[model samples]
Target: DQQVKQNSPSLSVQEGRISILNCDYTNSMFDYFLWYKKYPAEGPTFLISISSIKDKNEDGRFTVFLNKSAKHLSLHIVPSQPGDSAVYFCAASRTMEYGNKLVFGAGTILRVKS
Candidate 1:
């Protein structure tokens, strides 16, 4: 079973509007949460990330929030543009002795309508 899940498979927002992408995880041991954006025929690129200890993290127009108590996380993009359209994947991981055990959600397709 998938430990990480994105409840919504797709989201559409008008350009210059706020786009909020949500994710949830069943694993409580996860210490990190990350958001990745993938474009057509391109590799997924890291967007924003938040540590479980912190409630929120912001980078440019992108912000990530983590709610450990709820086992949930979200990415918010302000004034979303056409260029922001892509598939977003939420990931969670915990550090182990050997490495990190990362689990990814199915992904949410974001369409920014201009």
Candidate 2:
């Protein structure tokens, strides 16, 4: 079974609107959550992240929320622009003896229309 899941395969939004992407996890050992955005033919770029200790974290137009109790997280983008369109992946990681190991959910494609 996958530890992390993104039920929605895709999302679409109008310019200047808000885009919400949801994720769920089955692992309670995960302490860090991250969101990454990827353009076609390129690697994913880190977007926003939230620790289990905090409920939310925001940076400019991007925000990430974590609900530790529910094992859920979401990414919100305000004033979505066409350039914001990309595949978003949610990743969870836990610190191990060697290093941090990450588990990524299937990406959700976001299409921001003009």
Candidate 3:
């Protein structure tokens, strides 16, 4: 079962604090990992991604680290802001698949208070 799982259903943080989200997977076939942030009704937008070939990937305020050996990964946001408050979804897929189909976790809702 290549299912992605986010154990935490929600997280809350101060405006200038760090926000860390965790994820786990059981499928050994998943070689690519991604994080997406979503607002109320809009679709999720790709935030960051790491290939199984690499251990880490970062983009601006977001960073993703993949530990394939343990089937774990995390997304970190430094100095989290109110704008960063949203549902975060961890997704995985085989990088070399014919078409990229993402399997997403239930999602973690982040709340940032000023």
After best superposition, candidate 2 residue 112: deviation in angstroms?
Answer: 0.4
99 Cα displacement, candidate 1 (Å): 3.1
**What are the per-model C-alpha RMSD values against the true structure?**
1.1, 1.0, 1.2
Per-model CA lDDT versus the true structure: 0.92, 0.94, 0.92
* Candidate 3 lDDT over residue span 1-114, tens digit each: 439999999999999999999999998899888999999989999899998999989888888999999999999999899999999999999867634788999999999999
Provide the lowest-lDDT 10-residue window in model 2.
94-103
Q: Model 1 clash pairs?
A: none
Which candidate has the top score in TM-score? 2
Q: Per-residue lDDT for 18-73 in model 2, tens only?
A: 99999999989888999999999999999988888999999999999999999999
lDDT of 2: 0.94
lDDT, candidate 1, 1-114, per-residue tens: 999999999999999999999999998888888999999999999888888889999999999988888898999999899999999999988865324566899999999999
Shift of residue 80 alpha carbon in model 3, Å = 0.3
TM-scores for candidates 1 onward, in order: 0.95, 0.96, 0.95
lDDT of model number 3: 0.92
